[model samples]
Target: MSKRIDPDNRRRYFIVGSVILEIVTPVFRQRLEKDYKSKGVGCLQDFINSKPVIHILFHLRHTNIKCCVDSTNCRNRRKLPLNYSQWDLLYTENPGPPKHHCHCLYTTNNVKLDDLDVTLASLILLNCCNLTPNEEISIKELREFKNNYLSHNIKGAITEKEYQTLWNDLMTYVLQLDPSKQDDFIRIQNRPLDDSLCNKYFVCLLDIHKKLEEISDKLESSTAEILTAINGQSNMELLTKLEEILQYVRCQSPKEKTDNHGIKQQTPIQPYKLGQPIVTLHHQINLTSVVNTSWKVTDISMMDDGRLVMCLPVQSRLLICNTDGSQVESIHVQGYPWYAAAVNNSTVAVTLWGIKCIEMYDINNKLKLKFISLPGIMRLDSGITAINNKIVVGGENRLHIIDYQTGKVIQTITTKCNPGRLHGSGDRILYCDNINSNKMYWYSYTNARHHNLTLPSPPWDMTILQNGSLYVVCKDGSVQHVSSDGKQYKPVKTLQTTPGCDGIHYNLTQRKLMTIQNKNRLVTVYNEI
Candidate 1:
């Protein structure tokens, strides 16, 4: 026999689980209806009633379909190019005599809004529906809350304080989707949860867990197939294929500063090729309108996932946004944020102006991880970058490389000029002087060699492409491109802004260039022609 659960703890679980099933699930269904209607369909119910299995499969190609077919002989089955394993929960599974049946089987089962739960509703909203950035964020948060807080509580217990915190967070997400649901949440929270009601909620929670486990099993099978394919390669092809596999595996897991050997892994540099001289504006956003403030953007950096992190010095905050300029979240720091860098996919390190400290944040969780103070009281720290397992910071005419894990200074290098903004690739670090010098410098850690290249104007900030080339923004409203060797330079694009550009970042995967006009409070994105 299983141990009995505490009544209070069971009540806590019941409240959270009930809110998701009763309040959140209906909102997701409504949104799905709205989305389908907007896409030329009359309504979700009508669409399911009229459309055939082929049409449904096409519409839901974005979902996971691994379980729909036999894995041992998957190739023999008539499978669509994408996943749709969650189809049975939403539709009837009648193994048709004509496998590609055109009859509308979904409506025959009379699947209603009540049949949909939080997990299935969330997956449909995220994968099938076209959502605005805010809607996307809300749905993702609700899904995470279910997984982390509700379903994973093996003890079925939650402290009073934790219950309140979780309740508030869930309420915030629910309100974002439908403000009218506020009263529904409050009623569920205060309602008396008896054994019968709690057991019902417990069953719902178990259903969600089962669905999640199915998805996880499918992913594990897919990963195993990939490894098997890699093993079947010839010796000559194995080396190249192994490197590509490693890169893919790294992308799947949480990004780390160092590998298992405690050695820094250099990002593989792609071959350099000059792009066409033509520059086309892809998107632009006014920072003032988004934040409702005229505060200037101090610096900007791009995460591995393509989100933009911008420093707002006057507000002492970091404004995070999607690549299309939709606001994601805002983070407040302890001091004035001068420069920001993506430490990894989920973490960002920011340098504080007039302070000798660097703060690291987990942007995904919206929590501050820790603070690292320099050894001495060297204020005015400006430039910052993360390479491998270390952080490089610029302060007072010198640079300090610190281990990110221990916050210990590993090495310090003296410089002739105070570095303003830093960017690193492989063993080299590129920076511009803070004294308004018309020169850019590149330092190599391997040989301890420093090389300087004179530019047409004072350099403000810089970003490096995957091919090892550099794009430096200058004070004269001109953007300069330098060869990997730091020997050749030319103007790539010149903006006619009054104060020139203050920050620049290159997205190697997307092949887009993002620049910040701090004085104008504008952000412009450009595509390579």
Candidate 2:
């Protein structure tokens, strides 16, 4: 037997629709306006008002019907996509769940209209409702107006009595919602919510507003102290706290930073033509034979003063070498050092394979300062690079940018695949993915855009030059000279060693190509041919 449309079903549909129309629409409008403005478009209100409301209405109505249908079909077949992750399955399934899936918020099945009174208002204002919090509602008057049944149900199936109650509540809330209050509007938008995947987003958002007000009182008195700590070198804890605040502010009120000088103008993505090497190799310097490491060189970094830093993975040792095929100083670290990068004249940043932290070391003093902890990070096999005092550490599907001095994570950049070796030059960070079938990615910090380049044989390690050209080592014993844009590539040279070809580096000052032959235990340096 087909399920009867009950009063409870009608109530849920009405409340959900009312919440979306009153609360959610403004949030969507604000987001759309900001997105348009960032892309250098204008006429914000016109664009927002002209957005197809019919689609939203239809979508909500469809979702409501789906929920009711699914509830009825629950005895016949289990409703699969009732949770948040399976929201995509809604359109595909015959009797789908609601689009929002806000049923989890309410404890009871029979929620009275009076119970949701404060919640409705709070949700609207918090979700950036274009309504004043102080706007009063004439409950008695609205109840009377609702009894008259001003609007008919879209389905025309629900009884007039049931439809009137839903309509009355919706109309009352809509009338009271006024967005003209500047102070309330600013407060609702600026506060940052706890965005962990486990926590309920709406609950966290409300809690953050309360917490921020308390924090605001303390910050006013300690303004100078807080500022000094944020700027200090050893204040890692303070830096992390400040970075959290910075992240919130940037997300809430993101304004495009325009450069009037045009010094940092974006380079047009030119069609890459693969040909001969711009710089050829003259001779090879065998440095790996001196350092008796059984394993491969996972990472390599060249310092400003022409010293080379290389990390051996299984050996757990960092070898410091000069221009000649000689080791300067070799030191052992705690965990399996997967990657290393020269941060400054005296310091180097090292990330481990099994560890969730990046260790910053004072090489001259021979002491470890502090570890920069990466929260919820995993599968960090190798890629590490330093660009503008920030070290970009690669994990499974994201590149984490950490401040070298402060040990604070500045930003997390998502990727298409797991990153392997990283190379930074000027404003660009180039990295090759472990997956994606030998594809290289060029990420621009200036424009915050990523472009992909196809490569032959999965690239093990890569080095980007000052002019944006790349020298990449392949797993199939090939070293290719790839174009800046990565549209084309040419095999400049081929390594003799097969299974051990890994970790490529280019010394800027000396203009030499350095690569590791892991099985043969050799670090080969080739002078330009």
Candidate 3:
């Protein structure tokens, strides 16, 4: 018989959904299990990881049914595209036993047990390296990692040497996670360090040693010609050549000075870091565009031909502008326009806030057809974007990931609360979580991982860099640049701005920053800090 849905499935789903929804919240996550147990589901987390979800309903008529469908869909499948390292962990399968798998976070069935450890370890390792105590370790699970390993059999998969290296790295970060270290991290961010912090903590010994080991044995042999020249030629010419080679080595390895402002940073900012390079502006030039309208610009979209389309919320109008922020055309949108996104060179998609659906426009800014108009979200304050032939709309307590080609929801990722701003880049989605108490939720759609190990401050607008680093402007008037690596980070080098910062975008190819500020209604522009 096909595995029938458990009779207790409804109750179990209700318990799991209710418990997870409640427990993971700001206040509940802070509570101990002993406290949650008092709420009648002491072992709810344990059940969450063990629950077998065979069937999931996409839509349910009742609230109780909603629990079952939503809970089952929130899992990572092996078929999903994971990062290279995560893929490597999967390849190195440890098929010891299913019992060894995580019993509280995820259900183990298809993925090997060893992969689970590796996956969890890798995830923790990423966070351990990138996020400070202020960001990750205030929680109980991370702090408990030092003592508990489910049933306490915490052994390394790699050899002793590799294990020691990983442990040392983890320990160094664990110490940094101490509340004592957060002030230091924040302090160093405000000023430059006297010595090279990168030389010590920043250097992942494993990575460096691996790189060095790969070349070390071959080095002596590759220099055979030089060695022979040195040994046989006792002439002054040989000495001169030797001296030239030494000088070349010295030139190749120049000293690194973070104290200086005119160089590049090799280790880009980590995601959890709150500070980023910024500059201030006082000049307000009307972005000269030809499509003159009394309506204010509510949304901005960039076309493949390097033009911008501005959505006028009041008049249901779109003003197309050139690369220099000059106007190209003014097209009228049917009904009221809320947000829009660049789909391709020939098409752009718009979300009708006043109306109940999405509309697509031709490159000339002419309406092609109405796409998707889910009534549930149209009535709410919502935002939409067309990414990778897919339309992502946020409202109704969920993000509807709809495919434009088929007009279907490919996937629906529950964010658990209201998302203020929704933006997407290269299959990556970022939403400012009104629920994270303001933190931005960045999902690398391919890998199913948060771009950074942690969110910076609760964010307002976010722009993705060429290298996948996130340049975000938080409500606090601070701009933060977080690297994709999700590791150790220091704040900000200001390209040239002061407080009252508001809007920000990374001009990846041009290497510039296009920023708009509310504190000073000026369009401040600068080479990225």
Candidate 4:
């Protein structure tokens, strides 16, 4: 008998909008929208809930995309109530309008571990690079924790035992830190330990401790008593309570030194371009392995103390090992997290799908604070980046701007379409069409103009050089250079990504571009051309 080969992989992506609306087959709409209890434009949860199937809404420069994939199992849709949502990141352009305006991960699809044993809390101490001395020791002793769990090799799945042990060790570790140090360690262990976390990490860490304790006490009490306590606490506002702590934290720059202006000095630009290198994108699903590890060297990050942090993406969890990639120290994160970005050396942010929110954590993986619900959008493989104190977050058709100081949404600028690789520097945002005609455009958030320039073939991602030059990752696994304003985007003499291309980041100080080319498993570090 012959074995069945997978030949039905669909990779074609199309764009539809107010202008080039696709020929929506009436039969298709009739069959799919029979249960359409509500309808309109813009992402509507109410309308989507009424239907079943994987529905993705894409809003483009001058169009709108409503692509619905039939539920793998129509029955599962009814039984599980698993609904997908999209927002306004790729909707239509916004006029600066009674005018051009615009609009709107994880989990259920990830491995479902039965116990917390799959948690690898031991990675904290495994950081051989000395990124986190305290964490390295914790990971080493993780096996000693009575509740430690073990993770398996299956893709997208974690071993439940490892998860439990990891959390137990985390709980124990937080209990042992001195108030100040404990606070920092707690948040880091709980979230991704990236160096670019916004300034809110430390402040949020303290808030989480307070809130979690309150919730724990409430849970241990009777329902009525808990409700009463909750009501009383409601009298006090969360934002107001955090004001004083927020004031003490400063916006730590990503640079190596501080300037007279009180900000960290950004690295100077070097003259060169992203050289030609064949990069690939790994998007294989149902990958079978006893323990598929992704520590194959392309990951890059610095510690809160300013040391290099070597990281690997294993399924939903990130294993932060030392520079040598030996002695697994501390593996932070509990579930299948989607993406992460460092606020600073000491803090990072993670998105938890089950909860539909993004949280900030300290180096020890302790929850510092939970902010902004994803507003519930669908579409996996999105992006988030923090520059200075402002943040550029990818939604469906909008680039959500977050102000960490006040912990609020400062502004949500409209975009052209579903953004692929998102990078922001100074005051500009550069993004690609993810999977369209393969185009890239720049948004001068400061001026609110689309720059009227475009790149060839949709781009994969982009980053800015020290001289403020733009570098774009193309669909073919290559990098190109563009004018700062995106007016002149010409292929960077030579650069390429093959097999499949994913994400990218640029380190100004080191003059390096870190990226995950083929599988997002191997991180590649490249010097200027």
Name the best candidate (by lDDT): 1
- Which stretches of model 3 miss by more than 4 angstroms? 1-295, 376-378, 434-436, 446-457, 485-502, 506-513, 517-529
Residue 105's lDDT in candidate 1: 29
lDDT of each: 0.67, 0.52, 0.45, 0.41
What digit string (tens of lDDT, one per residue) describes model 1 on residues 23-136? 777789899888777877764555555433334443444333332323232222254433444465455655655544332323334465556677767866775667989899
Q: Estimate TM-scores for all models.
A: 0.51, 0.47, 0.43, 0.44
Estimate, for each residue in 155-202, the C-alpha lDDT of model 3 and write its tens digit: 101233433443333434434334233322222222221111111111
Q: Output the TM-score of candidate 2.
A: 0.47
lDDT of 2 by residue, 214-252 (tens): 344344334445445333336554344344443333222
Cα lDDT of model 4 by residue, 471-508, tens digit: 77776765667665455656644345464446566654
Give the poorly placed runs of model 4, Cα more than 4 Å off.
1-270, 273-314, 322-334, 352-356, 364-368, 376-381, 405-407, 489-500, 527-529
Q: Order of all candidates by TM-score, from best down to worst?
A: 1, 2, 4, 3
Comparing 3 and 4 on TM-score, the stronger one:
4
Model 1, C-alpha of 226: deviation from truth (Å): 16
lDDT of 4: 0.41
Q: Supply candidate 4's per-residue lDDT for 511.
A: 42
